[model samples]
Target chain A: MNFNATLIGQMIAFVVFVWFCMKYVWPPMMKALDERKKTIADGLAAAERGQREHELAEERARESLVEAKQQAQEIISRAEKRAAEIVEEAKADARTEGERMIAAARNELDQELNRVKEELRGQVVSIAVAGAEKVLEREVNEQTHNELLTKLAAQI
Target chain B: MASDTLTSGEYIKHHLTNLTFGQHPDGSWGFAHTGEEAAQMGFWAIHVDSMFWSVLLGFILFYIFRKAAKNAHAGVPGGLQNFCEWIVDFINDTVRGSFSGRNPLIAPLAFTIFGWIFLMNFMDLIAVDLLPWLAQLFGQHVLGVDPHHVYFKVVPTTDPNITFGLALGVFILMLYYSIKMKGVGGFFGELAFQPFPKWMFPINLILEGVALIAKPVSLALRLFGNMYAGETIFILIALMYSAGIVMAGFGGLLQLGWAIFHILIITLQAFIFMTLTVVYLDMAHQEHH
Candidate 1:
């Protein structure tokens, strides 16, 4: 094999060129690719995060709606309870007023009966005095007639 | 009178010469002289033609790639961007797939190697005598250099040294990746213990040794043989025209067909080189043999 200066020079040039290209050119190219991959991955991650957040918000909204519905049901039931209470209070008041009216009527009847009884007594006594005058066909003493009329009135 | 009365062999040999200045006394190899070296003086000159065009083609491709990258799209690509994206994806999927380990440097190195060698191989499609003839005219008439001494060879692929040099670079890279991955001790241990126990170290060492040296040799010879054969055919056909063949039209058509066929050769050679490089690198990264 011939080994000359030119051959040596060619060998050196080849080694140098290959080494330089491998060191400088190849690295940046690979780095650019890695960066591109990272960018794509980041984009996907952001998209996934956004989707998760949206889903969470939707779930929260659904829960709030359910809670609102439950609250509305509770309020309606509370109003119903209030209405029933008002009805019950009205019924109790009506019962109390009826009993008071019945008592007043009873008292009024007793007073009327007493007045009627007193008038009747007065009439019976007059009648009895007239009867005694007739029976004797002549005048009698006042004390005797008065006593008879009182006894007749008591019996009636 | 002698100049005008030159035989066909002398003409062909004259045209076969390179744009070199100095000649070795033995007529095989020498350092290049400034202006008087024989056209085919040294092994290096054998590829001087290819070197010039290959570098030029590489720069042009680099420029194109840079421009595409500068204007790259994050979305739908168009024009050069589309082509570049396809090429990048192809290298990743194909070359990267062939290798065992994911090398960060291998892909781009493969790309440059493929493009450079393929471009050099493409020079084989040019008529074997075209560039030398052109060089002869320029050297004798324009540059005032003797046409005989003006040496240049446009096809670098036909030179074994250039291919071997390139293959050697890949070999060195393979070694580096192996060492880096396995450490020096581990690398040697692999050589001594691969495919058997430590007692069979001699056999393992021999196998590993053969495998290591064969890498560059196979790579160089594969490329050199293909391109040399292709150039030989072109030269023989060229001889037809110079032999006073009256049917130049038929010869021209045949040349065109051969050039078209050579395109496949060029592309295949480039692919093979890149794929092999990736495979070798992949092997280097493996912890086992």
Candidate 2:
């Protein structure tokens, strides 16, 4: 091809385009790309930190749940022990009261039996005195015989 | 295009020429009517089509980039932002890999070179005759200009001037960095005296001088040659359409295959140019050079 003024024109155009690109187009695009890279890196780092925190929170929750269950079991076992102790104490008190009531009933029955005996002796003495009176109407004084019969009843 | 009265040779020639506008032989300033007329205008003539297409493509590049830049954010990127960021990252990584110094301009320069050149070269994949044919039609109907005189080359990189223009800009930057980093004396010394004794300074001068100049020369030529050859092949393939229906279908298949292959070539050339620019600038920045 024949060389001409077009060479100079193309050169000028080349310079202008390169200058324009450097001044306007190149920097902004490069800045955007670099900024996006940094942003992505920061986002990824934040995501990693969040994951770590989530894992730690889960671990703490698990530990808290285990501890709470252990505490509930301990409280339930303590309550059961206390209930058993109360039941044993009540059984012991009921047994002692029942034995004391039986002893009082037996004493009352003995006192009743002694009283009946005394009455029977008195009746028997009266009958014997009557028979003696019939038999010994002619012998012995009446008042002295009655006094002896009373002393015999007291001895019975 | 095959239905035209032009022979295949003229068609190929038609595809290669640029729409030149300059002072004619009669001292009249206007568009060139032929390739010989364009040459007659000499170095003063401007290739209007290459300049027009490149500048338009550059503006388009700016529009998309500016839009993406405006909407770019630190959050998840939208589709356009994603695309823009992908290119930015690639250029950044490339500059980082090749450029050792911390010049803020290097990445953007590399980016511009890659993007601009890629867009320019991408013009090659468009049907070789499509835009030129449309341009010819416009010239004929609207401007009342002759269709034969409406020479337009769409792909700018195919022109040595355009590639050299880009290379010259990078070359200037390299020189600036060289002098800035190593001082003028050290830079000259690196060129005039190296890999030999003080007695061999003359030989060293020639050797080092050639090596130094070859950087930009090779850079410019490599891209120009590749693109020019590719365009020529495309034009040659297009000529097959004039032979017959069978030839036209074969030409279509060939054009498709070549275009698919050119996708790699275009991207590779752009990549190579960008990498070399960074490397050359890095060489400039090196104090031990």
Instruction: Give the alpha carbon lDDT tens digit for every residue of B149-200 in model 2.
Output: 8998999999998999999999999899989988999998897778897788
lDDT of 1 at B191: 80
Weakest ten-residue segment in model 1 chain B by summed lDDT: B31-40
Which residues of candidate 1, in runs, are more than 4 Å off? Answer: A1-156, B1-47
Candidate 1 per-residue lDDT over residues B46-85, each given as its tens digit: 3455446655666666667666666664554577776766
CAPRI level of candidate 1 = incorrect
Interface RMSD per candidate:
5.0, 0.6
lDDT tens per residue, model 1, A1-156: 111223333345455544544565445444455566778899999999999999999999999999999999999999999999999998988888888888888888888887788788878666666676788776666676667667778877
Clashing residue pairs in all predictions, respectively, total 14, 0
Alpha carbon lDDT at B216, candidate 1:
77
Docking quality class, candidate 2: medium
**Per-prediction fnat:** 0.08, 0.85
On lDDT, the leading prediction is 2
lDDT of 2 at A12: 96
Off by over 4 Å in 2: A93-156
